[model samples]
Target: MSDYDSGDELLADINAESIVAGTKRDRSESAREVQLSKRPKVEDADFGSTGSNSNDEFVEHIAKTTLKENFGFDQFRHEQFSAIKSILRGENALVVFPTGAGKSLCYQIPAVAFEKIDAAKNGRPHLGSGITIVVSPLIALMKDQVDALLRRGIAAACIDSSKTYEQQQLTTAAIREGRLRLLYCAPERLNNEGFVESMKHVPGGIRLVAVDEAHCISEWGHSFRPDYLKVARFIQEIKAERVICLTATATPRVADDVARAFEIDKSNVFRTSPYRPNLRLLAESVSTKQDKFPKLFKFLREHPGSTLVYVTLQKQAEQLADDLKDEGFHVAAFHAGLKTELKAQIQDDFMASRIPIVVATIAFGMGIDKADIRNILHFDLSGTIEEYSQQIGRAGRDGKPGHCMFYICPEDFYLRENFARGDLPSRQSLRRLLEDLFHRDAVHTPEGDVIKLNQTTLGRTYDIRASPLAILLATLELRFGLIRAITPEYSSYQFEAMYNYYRVVKDDKSQEGKAIFSNAKKAQKWHHIDVNAAARSTGLLRADVIRKLNDYNDRGIILLKASGVENRYKILKELPSTPQEMDAITDKLYAEMETREEDALRRTQEVADLITGDACFALALAQHFGMGLPDGKTKCGHCTHCLTGARVVLPPRPAPSVDMVGIQKILDVCHVRDDPRFLARIAFGIKSPRVFELKLHTKKVLASLEDHDFSSLLREFTKACEAANFGAGTS
Candidate 1:
């Protein structure tokens, strides 16, 4: 049986009380214990024995000791203790705590405990000679956590794109030498064959796996990352003993999805209420875009500590920060578009309290742990309730009074809805994608027929954004069971000889090895090879060429790196034959996309309802996460709804009319792309990949009608396309 089997007998055992010698219990409890004690005790060789209640005290003691010794904590909170105990007991868990609720300790403490226990048992400080792997999406967060752990005399290291190749090699050596108790990496690193192979050689194998921000694995989550879907396969491949999934903003649906993905039992799911009484939730109405500044200026003058003002667009962040600076406020704009060095400096300044106010998009607050942020002002509506909850949760983390204000306007809502609608690809594009994939060459493998896909090329050809394209492929795999995802492969590898190239080539005399080394083109000092090209030229199989390259890297003869990653999938079923059959599949996939789009728009509407409704604000937010305030209290008593008993009503603006003359001029000048959606995007000022590719952002006529409603502009562009006798297309 699998480790996570949830049968009736296991359920009975879980509910039974502990059996101790020389102890008395109630009749019912004694009967339950006797029944459970009759079952065979299965001892696990790698992990501790299952259902070993005798070790509970030891686990609790070690957890507390580690907490105090390594992290300087006197105790673990109830949620943290339960999750940590389960992990030490070799059980899977899903931990959902509010932001700033010490979720990191839940996993970090257990990682330390694993090492401490192993050291005591075998005179070595590692988990059965293996390391705990932490899958975190934030590179900065990984570095920060690793640094903090190292400061506390714990062995921890992170491997990410920010690290140099030499640094990564050093980390690899640490892993092999059993020096690292914990390893942190991004979700996409699971696709790195070299890293995975290195991990496979660990003495015992991977110990415990913790997936932070695990909600990204759920499609229902607000920030779904397709790479997270591969984590389950990664666990299976590595034969990990236990898994723990952690997140701060997962809804109940997302929580269930994550738990099922990791095989976490329902009883092992842990959560803490998101209600923080110290935060005062408030909202106000804005009549026009220009009317917001006066209110914002007034609020900033009143609340002066470190503040975060969130905007919807990157340009909006810059403009708002500039306007605030004009008012003599020390402020800076933070967004993904900023230079890396500048962003790092800005973050440092903010953390050090040098920048009192930061105007930023949603990208600013992922790993930020500032404790004294006094105010969080939303200059625009958040994308979802989860997003709002997370952003506001960043405030008042120190338990002092923090004020959160939302500026509500009809324009922001309309824009968010349009963005959700704009994300869906056209049906024609989906059909084209299906036809292209179904016609691709299939390689017969033992499991099934595998097809390789260049995601970049496919996305560009079909006008699908990367996220939507990922969702489409995932729908095919999970929803329809048409394909099973496999490890993606890089098209080529670039390597430089470790020492003298001539000496190394002369030493390797095998036919495939000589062909690979000699045929590889030399540019400067590095030799680059396209494995497929070399295979065809030498009449050798591609697998043989790659194996030789990997062998060279393994033997330290070459420093190798791979690039141009292509996704691979094994087909599970036959392809559709008739056009009608193809259309059926395409329409189902398109409907899946539509469902997600509608879900996003619904979340936007929920945020609007939260602001405009009369319910207690904090209670409403908690209820959204399938919880209530502590002590069964329904009202927070400190929110705007509780204090004022007034709802914020944002008056709607009049519908915008189309400008025929401006539209004609745009059509006349912007002839680079005939797709109606592309024209609509230009008119609505939504920048897409094709817009930059066509250099349309520089056109003065583009976005001339950006002030108008996006839906109205899209309709106008579609009519224009039809009138011009060209059928409708998409971008």
Candidate 2:
């Protein structure tokens, strides 16, 4: 026989005998002993197993020769290279791998690869004009990613509201000149006319649009933004060469929305499993807010080293921080409303290890990459599972063991439910307001009938506040198919001087004429105030209102007669009667508003439900993008529900303690008392950078105390510190 045939036959015979001997071995004898006793020696011709070693060598060779030569990588973890290669091949990929799975590298490597390919073909010595546009939801996130890219010697920039006009101009100019390879911008910025124009000239015309936190685009996704709907049109207009959407958390529904927004083919999508075996998720429901502190104290005492505590409101965060500090813990608080510079300082302190715990709201944890956090605790239950997953994902990022505990209170559910209803107007109230406007001829009749009345005449005719009247009119014009409301313009002038001018001119006229002129001036001032009010209510720019007024003047519907005041104008239109169908129209409009309000509330609840459901977070996220989940196979084991039974259960615990020393420690770490919640968040280890930058290390200490009664622990710690003359007998 040939050599290969002989070798195969010999190996097969040896393996057969080994299997037979193993099966027939004594019950008490070791399996390893039996296998070794019957096994053939390595030098024997029958002993050959080279496939596994060959695969390893092949992988190693590729890592050293191919990867290192091209992307400067000596090794790759599971699924990293494959995902990167898939993206490079222009496939629509959805990577659901756990946090710290080298997700950024999946797209970053491909981005570099594309840059290389373009440079090679163009005979360029440097990286070419291929641009990757990343649409991030948060301004902070955009800044963070850009900063990271800059640190890596990559050209990146972000355009957001926080940037000054000069900064924006510079960024836009750089983009047009092809100096920027990656441009991070918020979805809202896409709606700005000036920003949109700047993107058109991006050097290579946007080779790829990578959407970070893509779940925000899907209405069905847990964190939906209304403005995200415009991303699709923006992408099409820019004609992005390729699209890659990325998110740390997403359900199937959210995934579909993302795909639709990018106009990507569903078949090209790629998703990794969301199951994180390294994380341990736990939830404890407390009976009351008063009971939470004690439980939290017990947890802190039980676990040592880095921990995060999450709370919803700023005041609660602050109060908790203060209480914990009084109990002798180093904590800080973080929130969005704080000044930018101060927030940065707090974050710096936390990262530098000055603060160990941070009490914070949802504002603190986006795009942060601190890997040493050992625990995450929620003082209050999160509104949705998507948020819960994201919060917990911050833990165990270093591939180390970490604990995530959530404290659930039933009352917190009501608070969350109320928050969900904050966005939309109440349908009943809206309907009533619409009805009043329609009846008063503020809106046009449904049958194309016009209600022609001067502002002064309308104000006199309805005895209602002029601002609310104008708001109703504008709302009807913009939101409903009502009579188009046109702004009338009168030339604005300094009121006192204009009043004198009118008197001088009317000196030759009759008493009746003088009276008419004086009354008109008064009405003009009131109208200006009303207009400002309208601008405030509708969230429209004063410039837009002024432009509308100019258009009205051009139409000759109203005369802008100068008055002696800065924006005061006299109305010239003759009073017109209300239309015949005004009442019917008003009733219809009001009913519509009521329905809209209800619809908004329902939508909010629906969002909450989608987040709390059993579907895979990644799959639900995919479905949001108009892409269906490949199959319902992936489950994120890191989620609270997945870890601690589908339904959350509370453990019986005693009353909570307010630790004065812990509260003081938190305050010391916070440094800024503007946002109290920020301090509370740090004490609980909620992952606020303010806490991290302060070098707070109370998470470990607090976790160790979690199993005990919080109040008792606080009292005991305080007493011990007092006895030991700690902080000059501060207790």
Which candidate has the highest lDDT of all? 1
Give lDDT tens digits, candidate 2, residues 264-361.
67665556554455666666556787888888888888877777788888887788888888878898888776677877887777777688888888
Q: How much RMSD separates candidate 1 from the native structure? A: 9.6
**Per-candidate TM-score against the hidden true structure:** 0.81, 0.56
Writing each residue's lDDT as its tens digit, candidate 1 over 1-731 gives 11111111111111112211122322243453443343221123223544545467667778899999889989777499999988887789999999888889988998888766665445332224467899888777787899999999989987654444346557656665567889987776665544554554453346788999999999899899877887887887666778999998888899999988888999999999899989999998888778888999999999989999999989999999999999999999998888878898999999999999999998799879999999999999899899999999999889899999999887776678658856776677789899988888898855478999988888777777777888788778766788766556677689988876568777788877877866789899888888877877888866677667766776787887777767888888887767998999998888888899889888899999998887999998999888999999978998888989777777976776788888888898887334677787777776666667778879897668777766677788778877665543431
- The global C-alpha lDDT for each of the candidates, from Candidate 1 onward, is 0.78, 0.53
> Candidate 2, TM-score vs. the true structure?
0.56
Instruction: For candidate 1, give the lDDT of residue 316.
Output: 95
For candidate 1, the per-residue lDDT at 545 reads 78
TM-score of 1: 0.81
The lowest-lDDT stretch of 10 consecutive residues in candidate 2 is 2-11
